[model samples]
Target: MSLEIKEQSEVSPFLSDAARSAAIDNKEKEIKDAQHENDDIMCGFWIFKGPLLQRFATETMYVTIYGVSGCFMAMCFAYFSGTITTLEKRYKIPTKTLGIISVGNDMTTMFGSALIGYYLRKVHRPRWMGIGLFTIVIFCLLNCSLHFIYGAGEDALKLTREFGDLQNITGNLTGSHKDQKLCMSEESTCMQENSIWGPQLILFGAQFILGIGQALFIVIGLAYMDDNTTKSKTPAMLSFSTFLRMLGPAVGYSLASVCLRWYIDPTTEPLIKPEDPRWLGAYWIGWLILAAITFLIACLMTLFPKELPSTRARRLKCEKDDIQNPMDQQMDLSLSGMWCSLKHLATNKVYVYNTFASILYFFGYMVYWIFTPKYIETQYQQSASMATMATGTVALGFSAGGVLLSGYIVSKYQPSARSMAAWNAIVDFLTVAGILCYVVIGCEGSDKLSSMAVTSADSCSASCHCEYVHYAPICSPNNDTYISACHAGCTDNTKDQLGRTLYTGCQCIAPSNSTSVPELQYAVDGPCHVDCFNQFLIFLAVMCFLKLVGASSKSTNLLIALRCIPPEEKSFALGVGSMVASLLGFIPSPIFYGWLIDKYCLVWGKTCSNKGNCWLYDTQALR
Candidate 1:
C-alpha cells in the first residue's frame, strides 16, 4: 500500500486536478448508461430491450399508424354485436343460428392464432397484414351480399312464393281459421326447408374469414409493433393502441344506430317505417367504408420498415442469416419445444388454476356483453338503435376507465404476482355481486305490462281477423298493447300534423259506459306509458358498477397467466390460455344461452318450412 501511494504521489504533479475530476465524471456517466441499456422491461408476455437513450424522429408516425390499425382490428366486433338483432330480423335468422355464427369466430380464432404465432417468426409482417386485411374486405363484401340477394332478388321470389299460400289466409294467430289451414302446402314447405343452407353457408363463411383476419391482424400487428420500437416507448405505444381500439365500439354502435334506421336496399323503398318491427337496415354499407379505410392504412403501413433505427441494436445482438427479406427466414418450428412448454404449463398449478377461473369469467362476460342490447330492448321496449347506443355507452366508457385505472394502480404500486391475484380475486367477487343485480333490477317483460301485453284473439282482435304481418303498433283505450292497427280493428289509417301515424275507429276498444261505441280512439307508435324509463335507468346504473368492477380482468388475466408460467413458455401459455377460454367460454356460452332463450319464444315467425325465427319473446318465461 505504501509503495503504490508513493508511486501515485510522484505521478500526481504531472496531472491536473480538473482533468482527474473530468475523467471520474465521464466514467460514472458510462456506467449509468450501460446499466440502463442492460435492463429488460417486462410487458405482458414479452420482455423488451430498454433505454435507447437517443430519440428517433419517426416514432410519432409509427405510433399513430399502429394505433389506428388496432382501431380497425376492433371495428368488426363492435359493429357485429350492435347489429346482431338487425341481422337476425332481416335474414330471418334465429338466436341459435346467430350463436352458430359466433362459434365460427371462436373456433377460427384459436386455430388462426396458433398458426399465425408459429409462422410469424418467419413471415414479413406488413405483407401478412395486407393479405389478411384484403381477405377481410372480400369476405365482408360477400357477407353484405345477403341483403341484395336474400330479400330483393331471386331469393326473395322464393320466399314470396312460399308465403303466397298464406296470402289468402287470415287470422292464423288464433284458430279462428280453424275451418281452414293457415300455413303453406306440404310440397312448398319441404322444398323451402332445404333452401336455408345457402344463407347459412354465406353467414358462416363470412364469419370464419373475419375470425382468421382478426387473429392475423391483432397478433401480428402487436408483435410487429413491439419488434420495431424501443422498450421505453413500446408500453405507451401498446397502451394507446389498446385505448384507441376500445373507441371502435363507441363509433361502430353510433354509426350502426343511424344506418339501421335506413332501408337495407338504398334504391328500393322500404315496406315499413323505421319504427316497425319488420324494418331491415343497411348493415353492409359500413363494411365497405371500413374496408376502404383499412386499405388506405394497410398500404401506408407497407412502407413502414421491419424494424426502426432504435431497434437496430437489439436486432444485431442475435445472429442471423443473410436474406432479402428477414421475416421470410426459417425459424424453430419443431414441435418438441412447444410440447415441452405446454407440459410445463399444464403442471404449473397457479397457471392451470387461473386459466380455469378465466373460463368462468369469460363465460359470464360473453353472456352479458353479447346480449345486453337485446336485453335492454326487450326489457324497456326501446328501439334496437336506442338499446345499442345505451349499451355502447356503458361498454366503451366504463370498460376503458377500468382498464386505465388498473394500469395506473399497477404502475404506481408495481404489484407482485401474489398482490395482483388478490386484487383480481376481490374485484371478481364483487363483479358476481353486481351481476346478481340484473335479475332483481330489470323492468317487467312487455307481456307483464298492461299496455304492452299480447292480447288473446277472443277478447280483442277476434273480429279483425288480422294476419299478424304488419307490425304498426297501436294502443287501445284500455291501455293494452295490440300488434298493429289491423289487430285493433281500425278501419282508417291517417297521419297527424306532427307526422305521427294514427289509427282511428278501433273496434277493439271496449266501451267505457253502456254506449255502443267508444269515443274516437287514437293509437300512435311506441310505448304509451312513460314510466318504464325509470326501470331502464336503474338497470343502466347497476350495469355501470358491474363494469367498473370487472373491466380490468381482461388485461389482468394475461398478466397473471404470464407471471405464473416459465419465461420461455409465456407466448405458448397465452395462446393456450386463449384457446381454453374460447373453447369453454366464447364458443359455447352463446349457444347455451341461445338454447335457453329459444324456450321462451312467445311467437315464432315463419321462414319456409323449418322453425324460422323468434318474433316475440316470452319475457316472463325467460330465466
Candidate 2:
C-alpha cells in the first residue's frame, strides 16, 4: 500500500485551464434555459392564476350593480317628466312653460355629460360614480318636495275655479250679445293666465338636477364598463346595459300609475281636482320613495373598489411591454380636422344620404314616443296615470322587440358599414310611412259621438220660455252643447229667447214649449274622429320597428368602423363618433322640432277654447 501511494504522487499534476472553461460554459447555458422558463411562466395565466376568479367576480359585480343603477336613473327621469306633463295639463298651466322646463333639463344634461367626461379623465371613475349617485338622491328629494313648495292643491283650486266659472257661463250663453262678449272675454282671460312662473321655476330646477344626475351616471358608468371589459365585448355590453336601464322607466311609470289609482278618488269626476289633497301627497310619496332608492344606490357606490385592477402598476407595466400602445397617435384637436370631417360628411354622397336618412328616421321615432301619451289622454280621455302606464307598456314592447331583432339581424346579415347606411335609409322610408299614418289619424279626431244631450218635457213651460238644455256623456269630457227655442216669445233681439251653452258642466237646461216640436239635433259621430288609442298603438309598433332598425344599423356600422381601424385606434374612433352624434343627432333635433311645432300652431287657426276643449290641441303643439 505504501509503494502504490508513492507512485501516484509522482504522476499527479494540476488540470489544464481549457477543461475548467468548458465546465463554466455548461453552467452558464443551464442558467439561461432556466431563466427562459421563468419568463414563460410569468407571462402566462399561471403567474396570477389564484387571483383570476376573484378579479372576474369583482368586475361582473361592478358591471351589474352600475347597470341596474343606470336603469333606475333613466326610469326616474322619464317617469317623473311624463307624470309632470299630465299634472301641468290637469293644473291648466301653459304647455310652453313645460317646454322651457324640459329644455332647461336637456341643457343641464348636455353640460353634465361634458362635465362627467372631464371629471372621468381627471379623477378616479369610482369616485365620480359615487358623486353622481349622491347627486341623484338630492335631486329626487327636491322633486318630491316640489308639490308642497308650489302649493299644488291651492294652484289646482284656482285653475278649477276659473275654468269652472267659464264652463258655467259658456253653458248658459248660446247665441246672444252676452255670449259673444263672454267668448271674447274668456279667450282673453285664458291667454292672460297662461302660466304662473312659480311652479315652472320649481319644475325647471328639479329637471335640471335630474339631467345632471342622468348625464353623470350614464357617461361615467359606461366609461367605467368600457375600461373594465375586453374590447370585443364592449358593444354587446353597452347594448345590454341600455336594455336594463330602459326597464327602470317602465317599472317606475307602472308603479306611479298604481299609486295614482290607489290614492285617486273615483267619486270625483276629474281625478285631479282643486280640493283633492291626495294628489299632492301621492306624488310626494312616489318621488320620496325613488329618492330613498337613489340614496341607497349612492351608499352602494361607496363600496365600489377605489381603483381598477387593470390599471394597476404591475398590470400596466406588463401590458406596455407585451402589447403595442393602444393610443399612440395624439387626438387631432384642430379646427381644420373638424372642418375636414364635417366637409367629408356633408359632401360625400353616401355620407350625406345616410346622415339625412338617420335624421328623418330618428325624428319620426322620437315624435312617436314623445307625443303618444298626450294623444292617449286627448283621444281616450284616460287619466294621467293610465296614459303613463300605456306609454310605458308600449315602450317595453318596443324595447323587447328591438333587443331580439338586433341580435337576429346582426347574426344573419353580418353587415358592413356601407350596408348599415343602406339599412338606415330603408328604416327611414318605413318610419315615414308610419308617421304619415299617425298624423292622418291624429288630425281625423274621434270615432265616438261628438255630442249628447237630454231634456225632459216636464222641464219646459207654456210661456214659450224656450229653455235650452244639455247633458254630459260618459265618454267625451271636453264636448259642448247648445240649445235654442224658435217661438213667438223667442224674438231675435229679445231677452225672452231662452238660449244656453253647455261646456263640461254635464247638465244645463232652459225652459221651452211643452209641444215636442221639431228639436233640431246635431250629433257628430265617426271612427275617423275619436280613435287616438288605436293611432297610438300603431304609432308605438312602428316606432319600435324603426328604432330597432336604426339602432342595430348604427351599432353594426360602429363595429365595422372599429374593424377597419387598428385595435389601438378603436377607442378614439368611438369617442369621436359619440361626440359627433350627440351634437348632430340629439341637440339640434329637439330644438328644431320644438320650433317647428310652435310655428305650426301659430300658422294654423287653432285656438284653446272652453266650449270646444281646444286646449287639448293647444298642448299638442308643444309636442
- For residues 1-623, write the lDDT of model 2, one tens digit per residue: 67445433443246455755565555566667766534322211333334443444355567677868877786676566456544553344444444455555556665456434433443445556777778777777776665566544432332233544555577643444223222121222222233355556766787777666666666666555665666655556655665666677677777666656543222224323321221322555677787888787766655554345543443457567886444324445456754554454445454344445454545445544444554566545455677767667555656645654664566565555677666656766765675565554442343222221122112331233222211111221223222222111122222222332212211122223343332212111111124356666665666566555544554554345445444433333333333444455555555565455444221111123312111223323332
How much lDDT does each candidate structure score? Answer: 0.62, 0.48
How many residue pairs in model 1 have overlapping backbones?
A: 0
- Against the true structure, candidate 1 has what lDDT? 0.62
Model 1 C-alpha lDDT per residue in residues 1-623, reported as the tens digit of each score:
67445444544465688875565566667767665443322111123222332232155666676667767656666677777877776556788878888678778877777666654654556567766676667666776777657654322221232333353365342332221212111222211343566777888888888777777776666566655666445434555566666677667777667777766666655434554455566777777777778777776555554445555555555435332334434435678756665677788999988988888877876676677777776666777777778777556777667766766666556667787788778878898887777676655536454234355334565545444333334555556666556556565655679855566666665644567563465566433442457888888887777776676655555556645654334445656766777788888998988777877775555544556666667665563
Candidate 1 least-lDDT 10 residues: 40-49
Per-candidate TM-scores read 0.75, 0.62
What lDDT score is found at residue 612 in candidate 2? 11
Distance from true location, Cα of 486 in model 2, Å: 20
- For candidate 2, give the lDDT of residue 498: 36
Highest-scoring model, lDDT: 1
* Model 1 TM-score on a 0 to 1 scale: 0.75
